[model samples]
Target: MGKYAHLNILLAEDDSSIRSAIKAMLFDLGIHKITEAADGEGALQNLIRTPQGYDLIICDWNMPNKNGLELLKDAKMRAPSTPFLMITGRADEESVMKALKSGVSGYLRKPFRMNQLESKIKVIADSWSEMA
Candidate 1:
């Protein structure tokens, strides 16, 4: 099993293809336990349902009914310890700074390589473990 196989991850993405690709990469990394939300509102609902919180949350920047930044802020307030990774096509400096300020654990620009995804996940997992 992979290092992250024990984790239960939540992914919020508006695009079905992008979400599937990310999920495939995560599975390749041995992360099989995953929950997906089509939009920010759905993500929030899932978060609320999971009181103990997810091990990690991967969200897109632009989503319907809440957007990634809004979800990030709300998620942080509800589950401060959970790690959040913002994945988006926008690589603007302003957005990146905003996500960081919003308490994101990591940010990944779209069209990211599989290696990059793995690296970010590892980094977040390590830091999150330390906090625990």
Candidate 2:
């Protein structure tokens, strides 16, 4: 099993191709327990349904119904302890600041490699381990 095999991840992305690619990467890392959402709204619904909550939440910046920033705020209110990672093509300073202010654990720009994703996840996981 991979280092993160025991983790349950929530992935909220509107693009099918991007979502599929991320899911495949996660699978390669031995992270099989992933719950996917086509949009932020669906993601929120899934989050609400999962009372025990997920180990991590990876979300996009833009989507139909609701956006990642909105979802991040709501999720933080509901599950403040859960780590949230914002993955998006938006690399603007304003967007980064907004997400950080909204309590995102990490931010990753789009077109990132698997190693980049892995590194981000590792940082978040390491922080959790430190807290524990």
Candidate 3:
């Protein structure tokens, strides 16, 4: 089995093309159980509705209705243990600090490679194992 095949991931990104690309990458990593949302609000709704909740959340920084940071904060409130990966084009110190403060598990900068995504996921998985 793939390293992340057991994970249920929620993806929130306003850009369809980028979402598709990330989905493909996730599949390549052997993660098939992905729930996608075109905006942050929809993603948050999904999080609320999923009784078992997701294993991880991958979200874009900018979106209509709610941004990724807002979603991250809200999701943390709902499912504090679930890991969150924020994808952002903005790499400024302020933006990074804000996301960290909101409790983002990791980050993927715009135009990331599959290996980079895998590395981030591996880190999350390792952390979970440690906790277990």
Candidate 4:
């Protein structure tokens, strides 16, 4: 956590396994300030309940309820400046464009490696400096 104390990432994945893996990555990066939600509805609840608690949110597209895109809209309403990273198993251009138009901070295809995660984080961190 000390290694990346500056980041507060949220893992909004329904699968406990994937969520755990993401959390583990954060732990490896020394980022212990991560929050988790089981579904889009749960993620919304977390956003409302813990406003400003998350600097970044990584969400899965498909879920039992609410879905990641819906959560993205809600999160944007709550924190327009907050960064959102969407993860989708469906790798179609339509879905990608829709998410981009909806204001995702980043998008990563499923079956992504930890290196991909790290690289995306670096890009986001670098871009954040230019944001007012």
* lDDT per residue as tens, model 1, 32-87: 98999999999999999997789999999999999999999999899988999999
Tens digits of per-residue lDDT for model 2, 3-81: 9999999999999999999999999999999999999999999999999999999999999999999999989988999
Candidate 2 TM-score to native: 0.98
| Better model by lDDT: candidate 1 vs candidate 4 | 1
Which window of 10 residues has the lowest lDDT sum in candidate 4? 1-10
Q: After superposition, how far is residue 81 of candidate 3 from its true place, in Å?
A: 0.6
What TM-score would each prediction reach against the true structure?
A: 0.98, 0.98, 0.97, 0.93
Pairs that collide in candidate 2 are none
Model 1 weakest lDDT span, ten residues long = 90-99
Which is the better candidate, 3 or 4, if ranked by TM-score?
A: 3
Model 4, total clashes: 1
Query: How well does candidate 2 match the true structure, expressed as C-alpha RMSD?
Result: 0.7
Model 1, position 103: C-alpha lDDT score: 93
The candidate that wins on lDDT is 2
Q: Can you tell me which runs of candidate 4 are displaced by over 4 Å?
A: 1-3
> Runs in model 1 with CA error above 4 Å?
none
